[model samples]
Target chain A: MIVAERKPIDEILGFLSKHQKIMLLGCGGCVTVCLAGGEKEVGILGSELAMARAKEGRPLEVVQRTIERQCDFEYFEGIRHEVKDVDAILSLACGIGIQTVAEAFPDKVVWPGVNTKFLGVNQNVGVWAERCQACGQCVLDKTGGICPVARCSKSIFNGPCGGSQHGKCEVSADTDCAWALIHDRLTRLGQVDSMREILPVKDWSHSRDGGPRKLVREDLTLESGK
Target chain B: MSNGKDFQPKIVAFCCENSGWLAAEAAARLELGYPEKVELIKLPCSGKIDVLYFMKAMEKVDGVMILACQKENCKFLKGNERAKSRVLQTQRLLKEIGIEEDRVTIQYLAANMGNKFVEIVQNMYDKVRELGPNPGKVIK
Candidate 1:
């Protein structure tokens, strides 16, 4: 899931200072599962803003709403009535949802309430760690299931670099050496020979450097008249 | 509401049923008295109390107190810890809004601590009295 964290309250207040009435929009998708932004979070943020404004002697009115998924236009269509009266919107979704809503309501001011962190998995109740860099490639099969691109301090394909000591990365004592983990797993599976095969230079064109990426399937598109 | 003395701060107490609520009930059974200005809302666990409830209560009350089980003693395990973090988060929000951080607090106690419950309530009442009424009350 995409994990994120709420921005500092002061920064959020700065964004909202000009507006007396605002809408706190929450996403019921990834942000909800990650506990960054959800219905409960929207209510909390709305109350915080209201209290802050009230303390300043400039009372604020906030409308709280959570849609099924902010990234989908169909869910947003149900919230048009709620959005009509707000001066601005504070979205508690990932970057994609924020952009989708901004594009949906071109004339209104929209601000991000959370900082999109990374593509991650929940390690425990409240801990999430990055698992994928979305490099537009897959190499898990060659290096065991552990991802060196995302977990290694340096994305070294053939690694356990000189910096790796006693299965720990040089970057931090708390970090496990990704390559060491990959090597250990591969060895257990009796596939240590794969380690000797030198990998070729990666294609950079498939990543973000290739400009904004998109996926299209003409057969699945209604316009294709399949 | 003033009572011919100094400002009587209105307080809202959110009590966890397993601990704080039981303490309050025991206190009542013993005929011990707490501040009349304090209102109690019982919850299944401290984790159920959201930051919004505290902020909304602040609109009408001068202060809010969240009473939960002590660390490592929560019936639901980690519910009190989650509540503590939420309280800290709310406190920061209050400070950002120019309100005193002391306006909201979370205290841990056991279900059998009836006298302790009364003592904490008294302490909060005194602290809030010094802080004065909530500034947000008038704006709301």
Candidate 2:
């Protein structure tokens, strides 16, 4: 899932200093799972902001609302009435949700409460690590399912580079060399011969290098006339 | 800072039933004296105390204290740990709003440590007295 961490409270307070009344919008999606921006977080931030403002002799009116998924337009219809009078929106969603809300309410000021980290899996209760770069390519078949693009410091496509030593990457002693993992997995499967096959240069066009990416399903579109 | 005579700071203590509340009860049974300004709100566990509750308490009180079981001694396994994290989060929030982070604190002790409970409350009360009343305390 997409992972994110809440930005520092001081930075958020700075953005809200001018606004007397604001809405704290939360998402029940990836941020919720990661414990960064959810209904609970919304309540925490809202209360903090209110108390902070109250301490300044200028009390702030904060409205808290959490939508099922902030990335979808349908869920936003529920918050339209709540946003009409707020001075700005402090969105506790991933970057996508913030932009989606911005586009939906062009007249309102939208601020991000989280720094979208990466496409990753939860390592533990409060830990997360990058697992995918969304490079628009799937090379796991040849690489023994270990993603070299994200795990490898150099993102090397071939087997262990000269920098790999004792199963660890040269970049850091703590980091496990991605190619070492691939080599070990391939050996276990008796497919070590596949490791000798040289991989071609990765095409950059499919990735962010080309531009913003989008996916469309003509069959799913209402205009498909099917 | 106002002297103790003039400043009667209102302190709210969220006490876990397994340890904190029990300790307070034990202190009372022993005729131990703690600050009367400290009001104890008993809860099933320290983990159940939400940040909203802390913030609301701050609005009406001069300080807030979370009393939980010692690390690894929580009856609910990790209730104290959860409460500790929440306290840290609320402290940062309070600091951001121009309030002293010292106004909020977490004290850990066993149910048998009734004297420790009274000592910690006295310490917090004295500390808050030096800090003065909560500027954000709602007049109404």
Candidate 3:
């Protein structure tokens, strides 16, 4: 899931300082599962912002909506009338959803209410950790399913870097050294030979180093657009 | 609604059925009284309360009190513990937005602790009155 956290309240307040009314948009995709930008989150933030504004005597009208998935253009169609009612939109979705909503409604003043943390998995109730960097590559099969690109402090390949101490990252005592975890996992699986294989230098172009990435599906693309 | 000497803070109490709710019923049967302005909202368990509900309650009331079972005494094992965590999280959210974190609180008791229930509520009522109206209270 795309995990995110709400931005600081003061920063959010700053964004809407000049506006009297705004829509609090939420996405029911990854954020909802992570307990961040869901319906309940939207309600909580909406009530807080309204009260915060009312305290200043400026008051604020919050039009709250949680679409199924804000990244899709069609999910937004149901709330077109709501968009027309507010001065701006403050989205509590991931970076993609926020940008998608902004691009879909170019005329509206759209702002982000959350900071996209990472592509992560729910480790436990109320806990999420990054699991993928979306490097346009998959290395899980080679690394015992532990992601070095995300879990390692340096994204080091074939590494328990010199900084790894006692199976923990030197950067933080609490963080497990990803390479150590991989080593242990591979050792347990009797696949230590794969770990010793010298990996080729990774191609950076497949990842964000090549700039904004886009996926095109010729099989799915409409003939008219082609 | 008067912000003067006659002011009464509007308070909402979410009482877990196994504890606070039964205690409040006992208090009523005993003819003990609490401020009418402090309303009681009964729920299955304190754990069932969500942070959203806590914030939304602020829209209608000035103060919120969660009445849950005592630590280690919840019928559902860790219900009160979860409620306590949620209350703390809710208060943190409140404080971040410049509202009094004390405006929301939690109390633990049993089905027979009627006096404690009344005592804590009266304390909340008095404290909220001193703190003045909730800045988060929505204007009509």
Candidate 4:
């Protein structure tokens, strides 16, 4: 899932210095699962914002709402009336959700309250790490379920670089070498022989390098003639 | 920072029912005096206090004291530890916004330690009094 974390209080306050009344929109999607932009986070941030402003003697009016999700227009439909009243929107969702809300309401200003971190899984209760770059391609079949593009510090296609030392990445001792993890995974699966396979230079066309990507599912779209 | 008036800092204390609440009761029974301006709130567990509550308390009071049981003695296993983590995180948040991080603190104690409870309260009262007042709130 996409992961995000709140921006610093000063930066958020700087963006809202001009607006007295604002809506804090929380997403119940990936951000909620990641514990970043959920309802509880919205409350936490709203209180912080209020305290910050109140300290400066600039009282702020906050309207908080947590929708089912913020990346889709259907979710925003439920709170359009509430959104219309606020001078601006402080979106506590990821980059995509913030953009979607801005696009949904072209007339109003929507500011991001969190920085989009990455596509990752919850490693533990309060810990998360990057897992996928969404390179728009799949190579897990060869890498034993690990994405070299995301895991490996250098995105090495074949195996560990000279930077791999004792199964840990040279970038940081805390980071396990991706190839080492893949080697162990392949060995456990009795597919160590596949490790010799050579993967060519990645096709960057599918990723963000080829500009913004789009997937139009012909089956899912309603036909105009229908 | 002096406003020419006596600075009787208003403190809010969140006490755990399993341990800290009992200790506060003991303090009351023993007549070991604590600050009259301090308000004590009882919770089922210290872990039940959210970061929002801390900020809210700072909005009105000069300081916040969280009283919980010692690590191994926690009735809810890891409730005190969880409260400690939140307190640390809340301190960071408070510091980020220019509030005195020292205004928020957590203390661990057993129910039988009523003297220790009074000591902790008096220390917080003195600390908060020296820290002036919560910049988060204007309690004039």
Best of the candidates, DockQ: 3
Taking the candidates in order, what DockQ does each have? 0.54, 0.52, 0.81, 0.52
lDDT values of the candidates?
0.89, 0.89, 0.91, 0.90
Flag regions of model 4 displaced more than 4 Å. Answer: A223-226, B138-140
Model 2 lDDT per residue over A39-87, tens place: 9889877877777677677888888999999898889888898899999
A48-122 per-residue lDDT for model 1 (tens digits)? 788777777788888889999998888888888878889988999999999999988888999999999999999
Q: Which ten residues in a row have the lowest lDDT in candidate 2 chain A?
A: A217-226
lDDT (tens digit, per residue) of candidate 4 on A1-226: 9999999888999999999899999999999999889998898788788778878988788888999988888888888998888999999999999999999999999999999999998999999999999999988988999989999999999888888999999999999899999999999999988988888988999999999999988888887823
Interface RMSD of 3: 0.9
Docking level for model 3: high
Segments in model 3 whose C-alpha atoms lie over 4 Å from true places: A224-226, B1-3
Candidate 3 residue A83 Cα shift, in angstroms, is: 0.4
RMSD in order of candidates: 2.8, 2.8, 1.5, 2.4
TM-score of 2: 0.89
Clashing pairs in 1: none
Alpha-carbon interface RMSD for all candidates, in angstroms? 2.1, 2.1, 0.9, 1.9
RMSD of 1: 2.8
> Which of the two candidates, 2 or 4, achieves a greater DockQ against the reference?
2
What digit string (tens of lDDT, one per residue) describes model 2 on residues B1-140? 35457888999999999889999989998999998989999999999987878987887898999999899988889999999998897887787667899999999988988899999999999999999888766542
